[model samples]
Every structure is written in structure tokens, then in C-alpha cells.
Target: MRVVLQRVSKASVTVDGAVVGEIGAGLLLLVGIGQEDEEKDLAWMADKVAGLRIFEDGDGKMNLSVEDVGGAVLSVSQFTLYGDCRKGRRPNFMAAARPEQASDLYDRFNALLRAKGLTVATGTFGAMMEVSLVNDGPVTLILDSPA
Candidate 1:
């Protein structure tokens, strides 16, 4: 599993010109499921995302987790994170999980985040979504589950 996490002042997802999911002062997550990803991967990622100390504390130090700051999460399914573009003009998605498996894992991952006591908003799985965000501190990080 792979996730591109961006700290945002606000974020929202639009599908077919309609807002599907939105959040204020939170993290925008572009999540990808690999073919080999399983429950363990989901658990690991959820824990990491929920506890990552990227938000700044009172002293202006990066010491606060999203949970500590009372921020929500905007999780979006993005299989393109697994795209392999090493040798061709077109990106190859062979490493991405099939939709059925990916969808199941994606849902489970969000559920895990919610179980962590964090408010989680999500875009429609498999839908063409337009995501907008105001990146806080422009802080972004890429997280991958242990192999």
C-alpha cells in the first residue's frame, strides 16, 4: 500500500461537478493499493497516518498529530500511485491491484482510520474525482507499507 499525504487547511472532492466529500483543516490522502497488499498493510498505514506528527505545536515545532489537532482526513482512491513509468512513454499500472480487491482494501483502510477516532471523509471509489486543497505549510509526504 502507498499513500501520498498532504497537510491541508481544507480539501474537497468533486465528482460529476457535485461535491462528494470535503474536510476543513485536515489531511488529504491519495491512497493506492498494490496487488500484494493485505490487511496488515492497511493496519500499518492507518496507524502511521493517524499518528504522524506533521502538524505544528504551540512552539511552532512539528509535534502534533492530526488527532491532536482535531483534524479530519480526506481519503481518495488513486491506483495511479502504483504506475510504473520506467521504460515507456505511457505509465504501466501492472502493479496496481484490481478494482475489486483495491476497493475492498480501500474501504477497510478508511474504516481503520475511523476506528482510530479520527473523522474521515472519502471520495467515491472508482469515480473520476477532482480534488482541491489549500496545502498547509506545503507539507507533503509519501508513505509505503512494510514489504
Candidate 2:
């Protein structure tokens, strides 16, 4: 499993020129599921993201978790995170999970985030989505489950 986390002042997703999911003052999450990913991978990634202390605290230090700020989350399925571009000119997606497995894991991942007591918004799985966001501090991070 892999996830690209972007802290944003606001974020939204659009499909077919219609706005779908949106969030204010939160994180924009681009999630990817590997071929071997399972519930355990989902659990680990969700827990790590929930407790990540990237938000600033009272002293202006990055010590607050998203949960502490009561912020929301915009989770989008992005199998491209698993794209292997190390060799050829074209990226290879063989490491990405099939749509059926990926979609199931993606839904489970969002559910896990919601269970953490955060407001979770999501883009339609397998849809062609246009995502927009105002990146807070432009703070972004990548997470990957152990292989």
C-alpha cells in the first residue's frame, strides 16, 4: 500500500464537470493499493496517517495531528503511485492491484480513516477525477507499507 498525503487549506474532486467530494482545512490523500495489499496493510497505513504530527501546534511547531485540529480528509484512489518508471520510457503498472482488489482496499482504507473520528470525503473509485487543492505550507509526504 502507498499513500501520498498533502496538507491543504481546502480540496475538492470533480468528475464529468461535476464536483464530487470536497473538504476544507484538511489533508488531500491520494491512495494506492499494491497487488499484495490486505486488511493489515490498510490498518497500518490508516493508523500512521491518523497519528502523523504534521499540523502546527500552539508554538507554531509542527506538533499537532490532523485529529487534533479536527480537520477533514479527501481520499482519492490513485493506482499510479505504484507505477514503475525505473526502466522504460512508459511507466509500468504491473505492481498495482487489479481494480476489484484496489477498489475494495480503497473503500476499506477510507472506512478506517472514518473510524478514527475524522471527516472523510472520497472521490469515486476508478473514475477519472480532477482534484484541486490549496496546499497548506505545501506540506506533503509519501507513505508506503513494508513489502
Candidate 3:
């Protein structure tokens, strides 16, 4: 499992020209499921994202978690994270999980985030989505589950 976490002042996802998921002041999560990902990966990733202290405190230190600020989350499935572009001009997606498995894991991940008591929004699984966000501090991080 891999997740590209972007701290954002606001974020939204549009599908078929209609906004599907939107949030204010939170993380814009682009999630990818690998062929080998399982239940443990989901658990670990959820915990990490929930407790990550990337948000700023009143004194200007990065000391607050999203939960502390009553923020929301907009999770989107993005299989392209597994794209392998090391060789050819075209990216290869061989490492990405198949749709059935990826969809299940994606839904589970969102559920785990919701269980953390944070407001979680989500884009449709496997949909071609357009995501927009105001990146807070432009803080972005990548997370990969333990192999």
C-alpha cells in the first residue's frame, strides 16, 4: 500500500464534471494499493496518517495532527502510484493491484480513517477523477506499508 499525503487548506474531487468528494482544511490523500497489500498494511497506514503531526501549532511549530484541528480528509484511489517508469518511456502498472482487490482495500482504508473520528470524504473507486486543492505549506509526504 502507498499513500501520497498532501496537507491542504481545502480539497475536492470531480467525476464526470460533478464534484464527488470535498473537504476543508485537511489531508488530500491519494492512495494506491499494491498487489501484495493486505489487512496489516491498511491498519498501519491508517494509524500513521491519523497521528502524523504535520500541521502547525499556534507558535508556528509543526506540532498538531489533523485530528487536533478538527479537519477533514478527501481520499482518492490512484493506482498510478505503482506505475513503474524506470525503464521505458511509458509507465508500467504491473505492480498495481487488480481492480477487485484494489477497490476492496481502498474502501477499507477509508473506513479505517473514519473510525479514527475524523471527517472523511472519498472519490469513487476506479473513477477518472479530477482533484483540486490548496496545499497548506505545500506539505506532501509519501507512505509505503512495510514489506
Residue 130, candidate 1: C-alpha displacement in angstroms:
0.4
Query: What does candidate 2 score on TM?
Result: 0.98
lDDT of 2 by residue, 68-89 (tens): 9999999999999999999979
**Model 2 alpha-carbon miss at residue 141, Å:** 0.3
Give lDDT: candidate 1, residue 74: 99
RMSD vs true structure, all candidates: 0.4, 0.6, 0.6
lDDT accuracy of residue 100 in candidate 3: 100
- How accurate locally is residue 78 in candidate 1, as Cα lDDT from 0 to 100? 100
lDDT of all predictions: 0.98, 0.95, 0.95
Clashes of 3: 0
Best-first order by lDDT: 1, 3, 2
- The backbone clash count of each candidate, in order, is 0, 0, 0
Would you give me the overall lDDT of model 2?
0.95
Task: Choose the strongest candidate by lDDT.
Answer: 1
Of the two candidates 1 and 2, the one with more favorable lDDT, higher being better, is: 1
Between candidates 1 and 2, the one scoring higher on TM-score is 1
